[model samples]
Target: MFAAWWKLGFDTTLLAFEAQSVIALRMAKLAAGGTAAQAEAQRMVSEKVLAAGEAAMQLATGASHGAVVAGYRRKVRANHRRLSRGAKAI
Candidate 1:
């Protein structure tokens, strides 16, 4: 009876350890995924800003029509607002 009790205790401890390990692994995966998503979002914002800069340069150089420049400016402002909102969310 004593040996049986010892065996059961050992098994319970082993199972608990395994459960903790699984939980830890899941947490690590979630953290990595969040980091990757944040990086992608930042990259997208950078691209949008660069495009906006290009648009402004073209406007300054008088390379595009007034209507086109105005449209690009509007798009840039929209993107900036979106980025700001996302930042607030984070």
Candidate 2:
């Protein structure tokens, strides 16, 4: 549903970002509730899960016909870079 709609130009990138953010928050929660070793393991597993999700989203969006998803991803990376630089200036 989301991937298809996103392919149709429905702000899918934001959805992906939101999903990733939620996963990060969950990772933090797990870290806070566990011993150091447990936390580390949880973090590592969480990172792998997050990375997989990100990769899938990227492939799904990037490999679409006519490069539509790829174009969007490029613009997003450019904007993120700009924002990071701006934050550094602040």
Candidate 3:
């Protein structure tokens, strides 16, 4: 149980950091006149917002921190798998 909490915190922090990096990179490209970056940046931003809202709801309802993190992990892994197959995020 302790390990689960630790992993959740660690993973959540890492995910947030990665989201910032993605946003920065996309914004840079968009600034450089890459029109396509606009959509990509928007999508990343939306994903972050969506995840935060969902996490908040889960916590409000008394979901375990570890369970919430695991839920995100599953989604991330599913996205990873889809991308590996040359697809978009699920």
Candidate 4:
């Protein structure tokens, strides 16, 4: 139980930083102004909506705090990897 809580806290902190970087990269993509920028904006909105749906499902299912944090941590890690690779990878 203690380990779960600790891992949740650590993952949350790392996600926070990675989330910021993802947003920064997304912002830069949007600012570039092109068809790809339009796609990027749409993708961002779609992802947010999907995340909200997942959160709703988690709430309804009574998922643990650790589970919720871990889910988001995984997502942010994937996003960090994708965005870090290149603008076209994601």
Task: Give the best candidate by lDDT.
Answer: 4
Evaluate residue 34 in candidate 1 and report its C-alpha lDDT on the 0 to 100 scale.
78
Model 2 C-alpha lDDT per residue in residues 1-90, reported as the tens digit of each score: 677665656456654674454445445545555474375466557755765576677677765532544544554455455434534543
- Residue 11's lDDT within candidate 4 is 79
Each candidate's lDDT (Cα)? 0.56, 0.54, 0.65, 0.80
Candidate 1 whole-model C-alpha lDDT, 0 to 1? 0.56
Whole-model lDDT for model 2 versus the true structure? 0.54
Query: Which of the two candidates, 3 or 4, achieves a greater lDDT against the reference?
Result: 4
lDDT of 3 by residue, 1-90 (tens): 788767877988876665455445555555655445566567667976998899999999999887777777765655444333432321
Q: How do all models score by TM-score? A: 0.34, 0.32, 0.54, 0.80
Model 4, residue 54: what's the lDDT?
92
Off by over 4 Å in 1: 34-90
lDDT of 4 at 2: 88
| Highest TM-score scorer | 4
lDDT of 3 at 59: 97
Candidate 3 residue pairs that clash:
none
- Model 1: per-residue lDDT, tens digit, 1-90? 787667656655554555454445434444556775566557656866876787677878776444444454455455455544555554
Cα miss at 65, model 2 (Å)?
15
Total backbone collisions for each predicted model:
0, 0, 0, 0
Per-residue lDDT of 18-52 in model 4, one digit per residue for the tens?
A: 88989888787788889978987898789888887
